[model samples]
Target: MSRLTRTGQNVLTEAMMRIAVLGGTGLMGKLVVTAARDAGHDVVIAARSTGVDISTGMGMDAAFDGVDAVVDVSDHVTNNAKKAVAFFESAAENIAKAERKAGVKHHVLLSIVNCDDPRLKAFGYYQGKAAQERAVEASGIPFTILRSTQWFEFGEKTVSVMGFGPVALVPRMLSRPVAAKTVARSLLNCVEQGPSGRAADLAGPEDLEIPAMTRTILQRRGQRKLLIPISVPGAGKAMRSGALLPGPGSMSAGPTLEEWLSAR
Candidate 1:
């Protein structure tokens, strides 16, 4: 039996069942794991820490033995197209193989919004994401792909990598960043409801620029640093044009940027 539940505006019905989360120890995965368990579902953590390596398909078969669904929140952090493509494609293939053998009913994948836009072609990370989508489509498994905008927490992540001694040079990009917690909840909702080819794109309430978002985070953290937003030739220019922002049909959720910072 299923009951109606809401995760923002969408009305979904959920049932308790066992589910496996690949990369379950990572940021998004950890959130999904906790949420699913709290909701009365058996949650399996399929990650290297748990001996199930999705990248190499190690221990995947046994880990997914009786799992009803699998939420793949695995990520490959790289700016190089080649490395990103290699990691995502291999991981997707491995996941497909394991799920096939285990007869996992649903495959939920977390992805980025507008990753396949021609304007984002130069962005290696997007390219790899696109490849993963294709691999899933060809995998012959029932799946749900949740494409989301950058998360609010990404501001802090960017600051860490882009900061120099006194200044942080971030890409000049437009975005509608959602809270990571919001995204995690949405993913679990997807898991409970079963496969829907492409779920609505999830984004924050307001559109924002990357540099300004980072500046706000820096101010909140009490870190003094000059932020310089530079336009990269291809991906940067595309993002500045709002290539990464959500469309009209996308589902919007909260804690706005300011709200997210205040709570942190």
Candidate 2:
């Protein structure tokens, strides 16, 4: 039989492929799964609703069966270092173990652009992400680590979380944030390319301030809210100072803020 033809620069196996997404239920996961399906690859959703607990290794092997690639985007929402460490270690260990047993050819992990920096303000989560990236990098499987910028959806959700009876308190920070859908599309492109070690960092179409993003969301939603700009320290400063913006040559071709708001 003729070996399958190379698609492009990525290391792709010569066989029909099935891709399993580790956190296929959340916003970003949903976008990844959809993009994968739209790209004509077989897709699997591995999440709590799908009978898989990546954090505890429950039902992981079964979910990984016949899967040639896995995209891990699972998150443990907390501020505690110990809990973050434990969750990340277990989730990374379980996913890596299951993929190893399944002989998965490619592993994909979505991470922040500056997570490798120990000095970032969100150090706890950054530590977890950095450790997770290390696990993927060390695993025997060929892997692609996609380091992307902050998503506009996240910026919006952050505002939503700071509920003030109807008013949203916006933080003042700097970001070169992309849309979640755009990130999802880039992930799919990388998935098709298999694993390129580390793909270029993905950023937003334009640089934006945190307060401006929040105000745009509010204005677009037609909701009047107190756009309270408060001074946040540490990680907040890092973000406000454009720490999240991609360095030279980073990917930055997502929808603009005006486009993002109009679509919502």
Candidate 3:
């Protein structure tokens, strides 16, 4: 029996799906789970901590038993091309096979914006994401791919990853940093709306400079560090060249970086 629910102006009439969220304990995954459960759907947490490993297919058959949809927010944080490719490909394949067997209807994927740009291929992580998108496309299950821009949380992490001694090596890149909460809401909307193939790109309210964002982070943390802005040669260049920015007519959401930072 199908169920009906309201999301913004749209009323979703899809069945009350038993949605299995891969990496359901992670940052974004947690939000997705909460949203699904709040909407009166059965939410299954699939993660390494939950004993459902998507990469190896262990315990997946049982997990997918009555699941109507699978939202894959699982992620492997790596910059190595080979490792990133291996993880996403393996996980996608395993999930697709399990979903096929379980007769799941929708497979929702969370990916980065501009991941398919040739200019960004120099970065191993982007390469892995591209491969992950490919793997999902080839999967027989009907799917929806939500490509989003960088998150506000990523700003702080960039400072840590690029910091050197007394200085932070900030890239001369532009980004529209969306709130993870906004992203979570969007993903849940997709889940309720069912599969839409390639949906419109999601982004933040304003275009921001990477170095300025890092500086804001330093100020917020009360750290006095020299932010050395540099143009990266390959992948960095692509990022700075606006390859990571969302295209025209993309869906933009709050809170803006300034507003988000001020509240934090």
lDDT of each candidate versus the true structure: 0.90, 0.80, 0.88
**Model 3 RMSD in angstroms:** 3.0
Question: What's the true lDDT of residue 17 in model 1?
Answer: 83
- What are the C-alpha RMSDs, in order, of all predicted structures? 3.4, 4.0, 3.0
For model 1 the TM-score comes to 0.92
Report the Cα lDDT for candidate 2: 0.80
The number of residue pairs in model 1 that clash at the backbone is: 0
Better of 1 and 2 by lDDT: 1
User: Which portions of model 3 miss their true places by more than 4 Å?
Assistant: 1-15, 160-169, 221-226, 230-233
Find the candidate with the highest TM-score and give its number: 1
- Residue 196, candidate 1: alpha-carbon lDDT: 93
**TM-score-based ranking:** 1, 2, 3
